[model samples]
Target: MRLNAENIKGMLLRYIVAIVILAALFTLPFWGGRYIVMLVMLMGMYITLGHMWNLLAGYSGLTSLGQQMYIGVGGYTLAVASTNLGLPLVVGLIMGGIVSVIIAVGLSYLLLRMKGMYFAIATWMFAEAMLLIVATVSFLGKGQGLFITEARKLVTAQIYYFSIVLVVITTIVIVVLLRSKLGLGLFAIRDNDSASATSGVPQFKSKLYCMIISSFITGVCGGVFYMSQVWVQPYASFSISWTVAAVFIVVIGGIGTIAGPIVGGIIYVFLSQYLSTLSQIGSLNMVILGVIAVAVILVAPKGIVGTVQEKFGFEILSARRWLGKSLAKVPVAPAPASEAERES
Candidate 1:
């Protein structure tokens, strides 16, 4: 659409607001306490995970329950690179993403052949198999897991900065992708794969692209998160809880929208931190989280942001491209008269 004055103003306003928010986040460590910094760090990491999952399941119609596999691979890659190969943690982080993409490429041939529940189950099984394999492998520290010794030299603030960068980059990548031709193909496939395929959309290629992109970013995010913890174990790294957290964040926040994960991540982190302190709840925090997710689904099936956007026409971060001006410029033809009216 041709840019109207209102559109221009709105775009400028959004840019200004984004810049201000980003500036504050970048300087948070200098002003915020250690606890707050750590909290935001967690929020960033989960938001990245949530975004990647949303891209796959929401836009591309690929509901994977094995994203944690990439997380584990990335974590182990980082650990081995730093501890055994004597490489910089930064290089290890990049390698994590590359390794994940490689694995994703190999898995896509098999997993992409399946659909719906079968696909989901296959992904989960793959993750579980990887967990067992890593546990039994002697070089990967066996069942004990490997330590990210290089991460020890880095402080919380540094790690927090890394998390901030990762989240920012991930968000940008998603936004850009959604506005591209590939994203259009993804949406078409999601709505109706058969129809999209008939219309000449490369179904397999689009799905594969989405899966590979999701895996690469997810792997990098995992590496960054484990770097903060300074440890990587099979059980912890390959836990199904990672996918569960992603689902909760996306579902509760608004699965398809850009702003859903951000809103959901904040809510999840806040509730998790608060619930963890409740002696009564103890390890049942996950149970409480599950309850809250169910409640959200029941109350607002589209999620908080999605429902609001649907009812109020308010989008916190809209991905729509308006064609109002272009459509307006087109000439409309008059309707043909009926036989009786023409005779009259």
Candidate 2:
């Protein structure tokens, strides 16, 4: 038997995707306005973060409440490396990811033993502890925190490009991982852990893998997220806002599908950005989002993508089809009438 790896169609498809996404990214920062670029970056980060949390909480059935711990660690690592250690912002971001991995291993060990509500509470408690610790540390300026001192000189265009690259890489990694055998195991576990275990899926290991992957991506996102702001503080970095926002996106987008997070994240970011200006009722934005999430879950528990799959036989999560949409018809786009036919 011969293996089929580098088929022409696959290679061409990959190349086209790469070119289109790259062209869009490079052209956007150059021609698009500052707010537009910012929105793009926001969507990228939201997609990555939402997907990360979804892997652990949604797919692997892990109820982690303390994802902020990794995010905070990554944020602080970036702050310390860039400010105190005098490293370049880029290098500091890498260091942040490396440090976050270490922290995640330890925290996972501590909390993975707990299940359900216990697991959720443990995660929350871990984040609270991190927040308190960072608050009291003088070197991190206690509550005041660190800012990228000379980073103002860095070009915004460069940051935008970097964010685009990060999103591209994250999307690729997620797609590949989800298509692999392990992704199959995760699905099984998510649906029924005991059954998957009985069938030899290694449920615990699969869950742990999901947690680590989710942590690593989310941690790196935190690093990049802070670098974008050029500042890091305990209150903001460790804020439950990350958790809340990610949760909302996953819930709204369709928890288990690849397109869910991306679609949901974009919607959440734009909606929040626009609705935040209204203060008549005080935080009506969150209230509205919360209500919407509840309604979506109750009405369409599978989310937009999931519901589409159930109703329309869509396969948006397939690895070969990145950026898959769930809508059934491609909108036949009215075939332009032939010139002669129109005349007749």
Candidate 3:
């Protein structure tokens, strides 16, 4: 009873803190300058990206090296739809997600067959192929890129709001999904696929669900990011750097934890920005970031948030099931009578 009460109190406290933080973020643009808003906006996008990647690798055990494929597809879809097809930016955004889902479904047949490094490599190859196709396709602006003139009409504040909403929605979806039956199945598969399969967990279906959700959200994020940039180039959109960034954020923040990506996104955005200003170091900023990641891995192993939770035994966003409480709720069957009692 005491432990359950403590858990409830902790959960309530977490909710309150989350609400306060979200409120501040929503109102930030009103008081904060354009630069700050833009920075936060970028942070939100990367956080969403990290969440999707975490869903795949950390939860579903799908270590994809080519999420950029969805990003590029989303960006290109937005560009073509809005620029050429004369659709609204909102419609284009939706189209981007839809197209990515379709593509994910098609590729899942082949990609899902492989496991480990083979799956990762196949994803990367597919992304590279997409880049080449976009570069060669004349309607996609060939090697140059397409300008999202419509996006230019929207102000920074509006874009910031969009980013904020995306972050909130993405976070909510992940939390709710993690607490559902599908989420339980995903956890099972992540721990051991063969065992999960034997236990009657739908392995392919669960993974496919994760992939589809991740791809759709990632696609939408890509659309929003490129929309903010007002341009989309094949090379930039399809760069492996997207996957690298997601990996760094998740690993540095703490893989398999909801709070990990959020913390990692903040650290990444600020650190990258600060590093970019150091012209003296030139392009060595990436190297510095890599070193930091290595240091974190060596020291904590589980990441900052993961290490903290392990040592302290608490979670900010607790997605784990309370085994004691769960079992307590299940009705126990009466024990069988002893042979002597039965005879009596």
Candidate 4:
């Protein structure tokens, strides 16, 4: 049997399963309350953002602290478009995404020059610069910031439904990316950047592509989040903690695999909420997170998914022999009486 056929079959099977899961989630907003909706939306953002960050730091080996740069840009862009331009909120949301894309392309040119901790530091500084710029810009209302022109009712049900749809789309994109040929280059880069380059993989192009895609998704999420808040301020809009949340989400869930964020974000979200009630400081949550991260790093360096793979001997990494196993268990056809007759 050809490898292509087997690969196609696997891809098809995954998509079919994904569609069903998404459909089930689409109904959640109708049944759940405002808080539930908020948590789901946040989980989606954290998971998506974590995956995006993972693509850079975990896969492409480009750690960045400035991801919120694009997130903030998206929020501000959405605000401007929805209000002054008289665009629909959705259109404004998309425009925010476009802005983030533009920023990714422009920044990659300069930022890509650095790598390792240097890259991370550059990104952190870039985020700070964004905060400073937003503070001084009068048209954008300077540091004081801008809010949506209108204050509206909760409409939690509607927002909840919207969050469900967005999460579905985001999840689909992530699963597809992980299963595709992109994973080959991504894993290689993660393992050894120099080797991946020498192996004919366009290192810069792959990294840049990841950045653009990651930033675009994060930007869109930021847009939605801005709308959810019904306000946009530079500090909150471009937050370092947003980046930190994403990092922790990926770390706790599993860094390289797509499933990690889903698992990790869900767990972390609940932990934060539960712990927040215990103390005004939420110090318990932080301490627990810190301890878990340290343990996970030591015990499951590959992350939650990695640990699972280890325990179950499931090979998600393509390099592993079993990853190439037949998704469809080919059955041996028994020779029928007619076949025996024909052979005779």
Across 1-344, the per-residue lDDT of candidate 4 in tens digits comes to 34577678998887788778677567667676668867887776666677778778878898989888877887888778877787777787788888898888898998888999999999999889889999899999898788765324436556555556666677667667665667678788889888988998888888888888888888887877777787889988787877877888888888877677788878778877887888787556677778878898898887888789779976443333233253334434554678669899
Per-model TM values vs. the true structure: 0.93, 0.85, 0.93, 0.84
Query: Could you give candidate 2's per-residue lDDT for residues 95-169 as a string of tens digits?
Result: 777777777777777777778899888888888988999999998889988886645666667677667777777
> Against the true structure, candidate 2 has what lDDT?
0.79
lDDT of 4 at 315: 49
Superposed Cα deviation of residue 327, candidate 2 (Å): 28
**Model 3 Cα lDDT, one tens digit per residue, 106-190:** 9999999999999999999999999999999988899999998889999999888888998899999999999889999999999
Task: Give the better candidate number (3 or 4) by TM-score.
Answer: 3
Task: Rate residue 105 of model 4 by lDDT.
Answer: 89
Write candidate 1's Cα lDDT for 1-344 as tens digits: 45789988998999999999999999999999999999999999999999999998989888999999999999999999999999999899989999999989998999999998999999999999999999999999888899999999999999999899999999999889987889888888889999999999998899999998999999999999999999999998999999999999999999889899998998989988998888465449888899999999999998988999999987776667556643655545755999999999
- What's model 2's lDDT at 80? 82
Candidate 4 structure lDDT: 0.77
Model 4 scores a TM of: 0.84
Q: List the residue pairs that clash in candidate 2.
A: none
The predictions' CA RMSDs to the true structure, in order, are 3.3, 10.6, 3.2, 6.8
**Can you tell me which runs of candidate 4 are displaced by over 4 Å?**
1-20, 150-154, 282-288, 315-344
Best to worst by TM-score, what's the order? 1, 3, 2, 4
